[model samples]
Target: MESTQTVPINQKKTDKYPKSVPYIIGNEAAERFSFYGMRSILPTFLVAQFFNPSSNPAMQTMAEAQANEQTHFFVALAYAMPLVGGILADWFFGKYKVILYISLLYCIGHLTLAIYDHDLQGFTFGLVLIAIGAGCIKSCVSANVGDQFDESNQHLMSKVYGWFYFSINAGSVFATLMIPIIYAKYGSAWAFGVPGILMALATFIFWLGRRKYRKVPPSGIQRNNFLFISLYALANVGKKKKGESWLDVAKANFKEESVEGVKAVYRVLMVFAFIPIFWAMWDQNLSEWVLQAAKMDRTVFGIELLPEQVQTVNPMFLLSLIPVFTYIIYPFFDKLGLKTTPLRRIGTGLFLTACSFVIIALIQEQIDNGGSPTIWWQILAYFLLSAAEVLVSITGLEYAYTHSPKAMKSTMSAIWLLTVAVGNIFVSLVNSSIANKGFFAQLEGATYFWFFVGLMMAFLLVFMLVSGRIKERSFIVNEAEA
Candidate 1:
């Protein structure tokens, strides 16, 4: 007897991306401008503008340290909230609706900053809201970009992700450059208010694409989610009665289709385990690096630069490098028979990040010795860091999108974002530990930057080893449309 089974139909191949991609890109540009603009000045704002000089001397004495700590805490919370946001999108509201609702909250958060720039109470509330709003949308927005294509147009995924990152840098470059000028010249209200306006525009642009988007609805209640499969695997770990592996025993609890999905999620999670350490180094470009800039002379060609404005270098370098790598450098390497695998690119990125910190450590040494290093040294550091970002951060997005099962793409994106959260948390903990312990007082200077370099180097070796051990697998197989 012969048995019949249903085969999944493949989407038709298309050379062009969806028309709605522009709307999403526009939304991202504006939203990133809003986010990075507000954040660009936050460390300075908390230390300078937010607190009144009339406050206690103790508060004034601790201002800089408090500002750094608060900045990381805020960023950590923002990244952490993606976990909840991802769950809500996957289990209930779907990506589009969740993004829409959260964007509104995001707008409100920015407005609160504009309205309450001087009031610590209102400012703190605004940051909290922004954290919630931004964190939630972070997962959905990236996954939404992936939802627009199937196997047919999937070849464009890497290019699209590159452009997506380009849009991010475009906005960030504008914000990091302009917002500081607005804050310095017009005061905090106009600076924060400008971002609010941009955020509102971002929300509207996202909404404009509603009809054109390919909506992936929630998975609804299912027995094969990661949580269930994980629990099942743990419960049956030693209870395998036959020759079945523990994973096979877990698979017995789900339909055939679900087994593959669970395996993909598990594999991706394994990759994610070591990623936070990379982010721990990357996110400092906004926090500690900016603080370092505050102590340096920030003038070039007779135009004085704000400490935060130094960050504009990152986006500027990214804007230039993304294309160079995509069109030239990567292809050259490929033609030379050195195909840059995702894991390899990520590992290379990790090493570059460590190198950037080494530069920072050297610069810090100059500063500690009472020598003023040129801001150009920091520019060089940003150059290396931006290249690292192009390799690691963008590739991670592409990897998450490509590897995730259709039902769990947003969840996987959330997991990727969670790495950033964990990294920020690590920064916060390190800051606190340094503050409390005199034994590690050396952490306050060049030694601290060197420590991260060594730490990242260690992780790079571990990442490469693990990447070699894991077999590459694709959960979805494309078939020509009938």
Candidate 2:
């Protein structure tokens, strides 16, 4: 049965991508700009507005730490709720319809934040709505893009994924620079309102391409199973013992033996397992790491910059690095017979992330000795982290779509995001530990650094051991053709 359907389903149709892809990409770019713009200043705003930290120096410290914990919890829920949205998109509303519905809710979230800036209960409510709405929209939009192409134009998948990530960073870069400046000048009301406007624009742009999109109808088939295969793979802590491949277990349970899609599904899930640690660190941008930067000097050429403004460095570095990595680095490596596969890049990213933490630890020790660390150290750290992000975050996005079954592509994308949710849960644990306990009592202002460093070391060791045993399944359809 699988063999009969495989050729027809995967057969090449049209070689040209619908010209409307650029409109969708434009919409995503503006939407991301708005989201990151508001988010970039959230930690700083929480301390100053809700906590009233300025009156007391210690309160400032306490507020910053509390904000970190809240940020992690909020981001975790925001990323996690996408699975619920994905279920709805798969089983009920189709992807494009789901995106349209949720985008309005996202706009509402931004409005609430702008209007009720000082009301704690109101703000919390708004954040919850935004998280749910954003999660819903986030999962569906990317999957909607995949639905636009058939086997003939599927060769462009890599380019589409590349442009998708490029747009994200482009939006984020604009927001990072402009939002900080806006937050400093106009305060939270206008800063928050900006994203609402951009989100509205994004909605309009998505609609513009509605006619050109290849609408993949929702498959109503419901298959219930108890296990999450990614977690199951992670449960095997050590090397793959003889005849002990996780794929074997997956194959045994997957009754549809002829459908190679099931085999591909399990393989992707196992690779997905490697990314939890990377996300755990990636989220620190707005949480603990942002707090760390706040304590550092941010002056540039005699002009003092806001701490949040420094966050721009990552996106700026990313804008430059993406071209280098894609055009120069990838081509050079391909020529040398070097394996720069997505999974390998992700592993390398995890190690680079560990190195970022090491730099943080060293800088903290300097601050402990009554030495003011240069702003360049933070800039340097962002560069390293950005490089790591190029590998893990972008690769994860592409990997999620390629490996997902056609029937539940958006759902699987949400599951890939679930890894980020799990990572955020771990981050919350680390942040809460640092804030509430005396575990690193000797580190003083350096407690945050020490805590993260410990986590990174453990992640590096675990990633090294597991990445090797993981099997590769080709999903980039062009690899064979090229």
Candidate 3:
């Protein structure tokens, strides 16, 4: 109960960060540099460098469309694989071991790309490995951050996550800028090899922290696994003698802790239901947005810019805004008697995301109208999008970590990542539809951008309404302590 009490803004003392923080942060920065460095150049590489020159004009058009679709498919698959990784972490190898093993696989993936940059079959095989490796570690790394602290230092969780996100952007900022240049000037081998080298370094950095980390052992087999409980709940539906719901009956069969865990998960899932929509909008920065940039005059301040290089704007803003939000904006609101709760921040993020697409649509409209809008317009969109990312993505990490059951933290983290998977799948479908001249044929270009804006706006309204109804659960007590 004491843990549930809200500490006043000024009274909340900043906890000394864990010694392990630097190692984790260093590993994350390098890993993000590796991943985003490779990813930032993917769309252009697939569309331009991987084409079959012997194909007919119509086949060439189809091949380009296929390349775009395949890029989204790869992203979607990468995010989707976290489910497998999460299960492995929570139920088998635990977070640290799983991350270490998959990281090696990740390195191999990048190596394959460097070795076979010109071969489509080999390049794709490499992508598959990278996707699996990246997805596996995605949930564990964030959850591992939370594992580093307990009640004594819990207050600093938000700040640590801020730094965590800052490190991500820090890595991305450099990778997004430099990798594109490497890809354009020195070609794919150097681009891919550089990231692979970074990944190898990232793996080594993570190993350096092994002895220092506060590792949570796997829960092993449990009857209280979410899947088993859910099945039992369904099996026993309406079996209770009273007028109580099926869930209540199911709760009666579990220990008090297990019941509480299920309830917490339910609450988190309710919040997660709307998150995929936000992700759907957020992920476009890597794909559609880059495609749009390729058409614009990318010379800014006497420097020619690769289309992919524009992605640096996102991480640059993240670097600036995260500190502002952490030290200033959020704390200011806290002092003013306006608590910036995670859900509230997420809601604000959704609105900002919708607004970003509105900016994107306007920019697209100008492009459609044959007006060469300055690259600054796209920068404005990146600002809005990055702000939304800080609000939603960073806050969501905190929320998932704090709200999950002790044993299920990795599992919940995986669930959170699955929302990104869902979003990417949604984008893939949209891209497919537009490419195939199907249902979305009439909504190409600016209209496509406007359509997403409307969708996000609708999601924002629903998310706000739902958030108002769902009461937040108390933070989980550490199982070891309990």
Question: Candidate 3, which ten residues in sequence have the lowest lDDT sum?
Answer: 57-66
Residue by residue across 1-482, what tens digits does model 2's lDDT show? 35332235656556576676887799899889878888888888877788654548656555666677677777888898887777777777778888878888888888899999989778878888788887777877777777777656777777887898789989987887888788889988988888878988988888888887777777664553223433444455254467665444443334343234545666677877768877887788666566667677878889777788788888788888888999998789989999697777887788788778778778777876768787788778888999999988888777776665553354556678899999888777655665675453233466666666677778667767877887765555633355
Q: Superposing all C-alpha atoms, what RMSD in Å does each candidate have to the true structure?
A: 4.9, 5.5, 5.2
Cα lDDT over the full model 3: 0.84
lDDT of 1 by residue, 1-482 (tens): 59533323655567898877999999999999999999999988887875535555446324555666677878999999988888888779999999999999999999999999888889989999999999989878887898998767777888887788779878998999999999999999999999999999999999999999999999876677767876888888887768765666776777655666667777877777778888888889997888789778778888878998998888778878988989998899999999998888888999999999999999999988888788989999999999999999888878776776676665677778888988888887777565555344457678889999999989888898899886665535431221
Query: Where is model 2 poorest over a 10-residue stretch in terms of lDDT?
Result: 224-233
TM-score each candidate.
0.84, 0.81, 0.84
lDDT preference between candidates 2 and 3, better one = 3
TM-score of 1: 0.84
Candidate 3 per-residue C-alpha lDDT over 80-159 given as tens digits, one digit per residue, 9 for 90 to 100: 88888877887799999999999999999999999998899999999999999998898789889999986567878889
Residue pairs that clash (backbone atoms under 3 angstroms), model 2: none
Ranking by lDDT: 3, 1, 2
Q: What lDDT does the true structure give each of the candidates?
A: 0.84, 0.74, 0.84
